[model samples]
Target: MDNLTLVIALAAVAVAGILFFINRRPARQTAVETVSHRRYAGAHREQARPAADADPQTRFVETSKPKQYRLLNSSEQELYHRLCEAMPNMRVFTQVGVSQLALARGRQEAMRLSRMAGRGVDFVVCDADFSIVAAIELAWPTTGQEIDNAEDVKRVALQSLGIPMIVFRPNKLPDADTISREIADAILRRNRLEAERS
Candidate 1:
């Protein structure tokens, strides 16, 4: 072959080889990328799938229903009835919430009152004008530090508001007349204290 022709042939072969290499490399890279994408998608689907043995019917969902009982127990019921009977003129509310009886004037007081929200007096005696006259708690024979502390807090709060609190022992089971007398006396004493203060 002639020298120029040989040189041309070699250059053509080199260009063809270069093009082949470039095209082949991209095809391999594309295959590798496709495989990686499929693997990632599969892993994601696996993670999202629920357990093989999981049952839809067995899934736990929280639910609630209305309470089906009186607020006071049998002993409390008896006392509540007696209080109601004794105070025919006064409005006697059973299981009176502390929040309903007292209001918080500040953030700290609100938080404190919130803690005492669940704790309440057995009966709340209100006058004809619907103003709270006193809060009565029926005390059992049981004694505990927590109970004593709660009672003390309640007593102080009621006293500060010029509302009297009368504690009666369930075991003693005082008569209706005695109960009425005690309530009357408390109301009179509270009135006298306010009169003196003013």
Candidate 2:
């Protein structure tokens, strides 16, 4: 081969070898990235495949049912309105999940919290800055022991987080003034208890 042609052939081979090594080299990934890649890879492969025709029986049937308008019952609605009026300075939220108020520390605590997380309080009272002041449950005459146990668990969970839970009988819901006073009293008591503990 001529000198120039021989040099050109060597250069082409060298370029090919460089490209081969670059393609073969594994990209560096962090522990989190590695796990994420594995998960994503599996999902991507499954998604790439064509989906099977869904069975008619298994498919969802269309319904004429209308969307629900009112979230709370009549008595609950009355209390919700009263709370809004009473706590004008503070924000009042209805049907708040237990998990929103407190956080779990460890795996075991997270498991414990999972049960209570699904359970929600009737109302949550928050300060101007949105810090949780207390949880409120309207006392309704309940039949089942299971419900009572669940409420007890919810109460204990809130209490552990230094949140006071106020129960009010639906028939005897206090006036706005009484509600304001009671909330303030509950907050003071909770602060005092925490102070004593610390």
lDDT (10s digit) by residue, model 2, range 13-112: 9999999877766453356689899999889867755447867567554456856788787778888888888888889889887776655334655566
Among residues 3 or more apart in sequence or in different chains, the pairs in candidate 1 whose N, CA or C atoms overlap within 3 Å are: none
List model 1 lDDT by residue over 60-121, tens digit each. 43346745687888778888788878888888878876765656234554465676677778
- Tell me the number of clashing residue pairs for each predicted model: 0, 0
Task: Tell me the spans in candidate 2 whose CA falls farther than 4 Å from its real position.
Answer: 1-68, 104-112, 196-198
Alpha-carbon lDDT of model 1? 0.79
What would the TM-score be for candidate 2 when compared with the true structure? 0.57
Q: Which ten residues in a row have the lowest lDDT in candidate 2?
A: 101-110
